[model samples]
Target: MDFQLSEQHEMLRKAIREFAEKEIAPLVEKMEETGEFPLEIRQKMGAVGLCGLVTSPEYGGNGMGFLARAIGIEEVSRVCAGLGIALQVHHMCCWPLETWGTEEQKKKYLPRLASGETFGVCSITEPSGGSDPMGMQTEARLEGDYWIVNGRKCFATNSHVSDIMIIVAKTGTDPKGRPAFSAFIVEPDFEGFSLGREEKKMGFKGASSGELVFNDCKVPKENLLGKEGEGLKIALATVNRVGRPGMASIGVGICYASLEEASKFAKERVLGGKPIANLQAIQFMLADMFALAEAARILNYRANWMMDQGMNCDTEMTLAKYVATENAFQCARLACEIHGGYSCISEYAVQRFLRDAWVAIPSGGTSQIAKIVLGRHVTKNF
Candidate 1:
């Protein structure tokens, strides 16, 4: 298999890096201060085609596919992970729509999503749990031309900022005595659908995370995604296919940022009339950071490739997410040690990177969840 990135990929990476450094960097300070993502930046991302990467051009997207998306997320995340995750969750809305929505549904929503006229969300987590679909308390029942939705979604990224969203809820009981879930398209303006309190997080401050309350929310019958009893399947596929890999790429970006900052500080910081780059201890830390970043990047790249190839890469992506997120935290801590007390200063990006890294570990799925997945995969396959 070829390991080299294509010319298009190289050009795309360079262009995105330039865009992030110039367009997204300056506003990061305001976002960090206010804990709010700028609509201005989101619109800019739409204009530049980041919002269209995973969608088809026939539906107003560039259709750059999955690897391109990973590259985009990695670059943007290298600058600001909060923005990266916001966009990543936004991207989550596209995949399921493209994969399952009817042509009419696609025509109605994809253009708005592609143009950033509407921010999209996949609201799957709830107060009960995130990884368990059957445990969700959200319920939807069809009545005449519409469905009534009731329950609450918590920890939903892009919660307050979203215009369009996909929500999963228990619709009925299956023959096996298990809860049957269904996916539906929900709009914020719909009656009985209201925003709950916004969360102030320790990291990833630029994006919004909060609760989505559904109290007999009325949803049109046409908005049912795929079919009844398909919500669990759709939710799992979206998380495994898009969510984990996207978060893993963010972790890769954090690794890159940590390594870059640590290396720079080690070179510039002076001690005993010499640069700390000459110190053995500093050198070892830098070396470990380098190794972690490289390994994490490779895992992300490989998983992205497998996904683009239409291979069953759930296990691979899960592994990638675990490694990259854990390594990201390690890299950030090492960078912090290199920065000494200055690391805690808000002026330094290292603290932000450290916080972002910590958040990434649990964002896609926690390390314990990943271990369980890996255990199941190995036991079945081997």
Candidate 2:
């Protein structure tokens, strides 16, 4: 198997890396401190086609493959994780529509989303149900030509600023008396749709997280994302295919940044009348970090290639997300150790990288959940 990136992919990666360093790196500290999403930067990202890397060219996107998307995400994340997450949310919201929406639905939504004229958020987790989306309590009852939705969703990313939301709601009753769920595209201005309080998160502070309250919100029948009783299945399948790669790329970016910072510091810091780089212990730690980062990059890109080939890569994707994120967290922690007192300071980026690294283990799915998924695949159990 060839592990080298194609020339086109390399060009795209370098372009995005340059763009990220020029535009995103400068403002990240301010955005983090103020907890504000930089709309200007987001718009710039759209102009550069970073916001729609996986979308079709007919819809004003670049029509790139998943590998290109992964590269774009990794480069952007290396500079600013919060900005990277905002783009990830945008891509995730657009993906389900592209995969399952009707032609009319695509015509209506894809262009706007692709051009970044309209931003989107996905609402699946709720106050009561997070990892287990099948346990969602949100319900959408048919009323004439509309569906009346009533429920509350918490920990929703990009909820406050998004123009559209892909909402999951129960639509039917199963034989077992469980609620059958469906997905819908709801406008932020829909009646009875309101934004709840914003969550002050531990990291990725510039990316907004908040609650979405839908109380008797009436959505047209045409807004349904897919067929009834398919919401949970669709969500699961889409996340497995799209979400894991996005997250894995973030881990790669974080690990790269952490190791780069640590190496630079180690080479510069003097101890016992010599540069720390001369110390065997420092060299070993940096070597380990470099090895882990390279491994993560390989796994992440391999999973992206598997997705492009239309393989059933659930196990591989989960493994990539799990191992890459754990490696990233360890690298960040080690970078902090290398930085010593300077790492803990707000002015230094290591502290923020460490904080952001913590979110990766739980975002796409927890490490524990990934283990269970791999176990089921290996055992072939129900």
Candidate 3:
């Protein structure tokens, strides 16, 4: 198989790299310190079409393929992961709408989302449910022409800023008397819809992460995202197909950034009257980092290709998210060690990279969850 990037891909990568370095890198320190959302920078990403890489042109997107979307995430993440995650969640939230929504639903929401006129968020995780979304307690009872939603969603990214939310809620009763879930498009202005306090996170300080509360929130029947009882299937499929790749690409970008920074420092820092680049220890560390980054890039691209080809890539996507995120954390930690005392300081960016690296492991799926998935794939044990 060909490994080289096409001319279009090359141009896209270069353009994103230039924008990220010039626009996002300079604000890293201040954004972290002030805990600001960088709305202006996000608006810039929208104007440049980064917000809708995989969306269709009819909906104000570029109608590009999945590889292009992966590339965009990688490039932006290399400079600022918090901003990368913000964009990634936005795109992930749009996928369900694009894939399952009726043409009318698409026409109504996709354009504004693609144009960045309306920011979006996904609400699946609840105060009681994190890894096991099947245990989610959010309920939306049908009442004539509308649905009254009553539940809470925690750890919701962009919850405070989003104009629209894709909420997963129980809509019917199953054979065992358990609630059957459904997906709904909830507007922020809907009465009884409110946001909880913003979370103070260990990283991704520039992005908003908060809780969403629904207290008898009323939504029109037209807002139902898909057929009732299909919410779990839709949520899992969307998460596996699009969310995993987006998150894996972010890890790849962080690995690349860590390696780049460490290499630059190694070339300049002299020890024993010679540059650290001349030492075998530094060379080995850099080599390991490069190998991991290359593997991650390949894994990410392959999963994205499978998606474009209409192939089931559950195993490969999980592997990509697992290995890439763990490798990124390792690379960041090593880079910090290589930087010595400066790594501990907030000004150098190494510390920030270290903190950001931890987010990848849990964002898509925990390492334990990935291993369980791999086991199921290999042994058919589940």
Candidate 4:
């Protein structure tokens, strides 16, 4: 019932906002222009403890929890949606390692991931598609001292940049003849592993999305992430727990930025010898945007709070993800409409925000998929 952010959360939000405005705002234009990931900013993000918000302190992370992670992603996304998503997916990769890794695995990899010395990724979607994880064609077989993996995963964020990745592959058949999947930790330099071409996308200009190819990729037996045949659990739990909420935060950020941009432009833009802010139509548009953005934020924060409380929040996370992403797209569209002809011009950031808003739609899962998740929950509980 309480809606207020704690003093610590408030302070974290402010610090992240200031960091984005100072450190990242200046680079936004260049990133959009170049369509390249800013590798230089990785260490700076690490230095500020932004890389490991949900990771435990024992492994050199801040151990701030998921709410802090949402706040950080929101503030950064308010300035740059691409960067926000990059950081979010980065956390997506780290979640399995931190949550499911063994004690030795944690010590060996968590420190580097926490410090931003190495980037991490999790690849589940393969060339066939992402909708069915079990249907993925990637297969791994046990050898003498290693697992030889062969498959191709597509639409992976940070595919070109990540040093380590959690790879999901079919290990064998279940007792019922269903595919048995397992998760493994694979290094990019491993034999038969290669980075594939990057996909040119509609938005998220500065974030990298590409394919990963594995041809007899060798992974040590020690690198198995969890018990054999548990890949589906790891992937599903991660998407529900981390991935959906992360994308929702990005949507909230896009909506927030749209509101700000539309408001500023309306106030400064003159019409009938007065500001457009004085017009009833402009006022109505802004009001709608404000409501949507506020609602998205509340839903996002609520889901994250439930997560921090160790509750079953899969339904909440999906609802937030569905609503936030849909509303973000609507808000961005309105902001562009409010700008009129200027929205079509590349010179204005509204156009870019609009493009980025579209990308958020399918980042975690499509809105229809989210609805299916919520529908199942409703059918079961209601």
Clashes of each: 0, 0, 0, 0
Q: Estimate each model's TM-score.
A: 0.99, 0.97, 0.97, 0.98
Off by over 4 Å in 1: none
**Residue-by-residue lDDT tens digits, candidate 2, 65-98:** 7888888989988888777777777888888988
**Candidate 3 local lDDT, 207-296, one digit each (tens):** 788989999999899899989888888888877877778889889999999999999998889889998989888889899989989999
Give the per-residue lDDT of model 1 (tens digit) for 232-282.
Answer: 999999999999999999999999999999999999999999999999999
**What lDDT score goes with residue 201 in model 4?**
81
Candidate 2, backbone clash total: 0
Q: What TM-score would you give candidate 1 relative to the actual structure? A: 0.99
Which scores better on lDDT, 1 or 3?
1
RMSD of each: 0.8, 1.5, 1.5, 0.9
1 or 2, greater by lDDT: 1
Off by more than 4 A, model 4: none
Error of 3 at 243 (Å): 1.4
Model 4 vs truth, CA RMSD: 0.9
* Clashing pairs for predicted structure model 2, backbone only: none
